[model samples]
Target: MQTHLARAAASVDTRAAIPEPFADDALVTQPQLKRLTGDVSDMTIWRWRRAGIIPEPTSIRGRNYWRAGDVRELLARLAGGAQ
Candidate 1:
């Protein structure tokens, strides 16, 4: 059987990936995260959070959301070789 990571990568369509956007401090949902991250799976995102590579979302009411600004900042840091 293919590994979980392999399966996850296979399910993604890199052709439809979008360019990263300039984000604000407004809260965004998982779908937005997937879009921003080039259509990665939810599981991948969860793993990123678990590994501390991504900021955890803030739970509000019955939903989870992340700050767009926080995501932008992290990505910038990573792009700058701060990893």
Candidate 2:
């Protein structure tokens, strides 16, 4: 029936209008770290890590990850110190 079809279409449209779940905080990874640092090479980060320049990353499942907020804070601090 036309009414039933219209109701079905409206239901689908309503569902589509719902927003997808989005995370407020995004986790940072090594690749993101590289992008933030503007240094493409892992060796550069590795050297920074070894020299106690950058904060140590937290390891999980034998992989390392840095907090995005921490990286941002470090960048802000570095920028402030430079000026």
Candidate 3:
């Protein structure tokens, strides 16, 4: 019984050590976008979108979301240009 418990605990530990999969194309909401963008304000994000600096967002059920890949690509392009 002790060996069985140890094996079960080991299996649980192995599963815990595995990181969750992240989807690059997943849709992220405004709060998540703000977090990704270094905690920038909602208005700043809105302005960037309005100015055509960022990719357009998709709205579903009256909530807006942007693709994670799109945001990452935009940041990468901007960083490359800045350097």
Candidate 4:
């Protein structure tokens, strides 16, 4: 059986992997997002979700997964104040 971590790694496409300072699993959870955004609240993330400002998550066995590339692109757009 594939280890849980290995499975998660395999789920991401090679092109979506983050290199350098950000770890392979850096953006794997909401808490990670909080760290990235300097304590951004869950409500803010949910609001973005409702507004379609970021891509919706993919659920595996009821767990939501967001690719790092998607998060990075969304963050970039948000930084540029682009809708």
Alpha-carbon TM-score of each model against the true structure:
0.62, 0.57, 0.63, 0.58
Residue 3 lDDT in model 3? Answer: 39
lDDT of each: 0.62, 0.53, 0.58, 0.54
Off by over 4 Å in 4: 1-27
Candidate 3 TM-score over all chains jointly: 0.63
1 or 2: which has the higher TM-score? Answer: 1
Q: Kindly indicate the candidate among 1 and 2 with the higher lDDT.
A: 1
19-82 per-residue lDDT for model 4 (tens digits): 5566434445666654454445677666667777656777677766677767666555544445
Rank list by TM-score: 3, 1, 4, 2
Q: What C-alpha RMSD separates each model from the true structure?
A: 5.8, 19.4, 16.2, 12.9
Error of 1 at 24 (Å): 4.4
Better of 1 and 3 by lDDT: 1
Candidate 1 lDDT, 4-57, residue by residue in tens: 334434444433332346357678788876765556678878887887777889
Q: Model 2 compared with the native: what TM-score? A: 0.57
State the lDDT of candidate 2 residue by residue for 1-83, as single tens digits: 22322332333322222123423244567876665554346876676687665778988897778765566554554444421
* TM value for model 1: 0.62
Provide the lDDT at 40 for model 4. 52
Per-residue lDDT of model 3, residues 1-83, tens digit only = 22322332333322222123646668878887665544556777787787676778999998989876776665554434421
| TM-score-superior candidate, 1 or 4 | 1
Instruction: After the best TM-score superposition of candidate 2, give how far the Cα of residue 2 lies from its true spot, in angstroms.
Output: 72
Winning model by TM-score: 3
Candidate 1 ranges with C-alpha deviation above 4 Å: 1-24, 78-82
Ranking by lDDT: 1, 3, 4, 2
Model 2, C-alpha of 58: deviation from truth (Å): 0.7
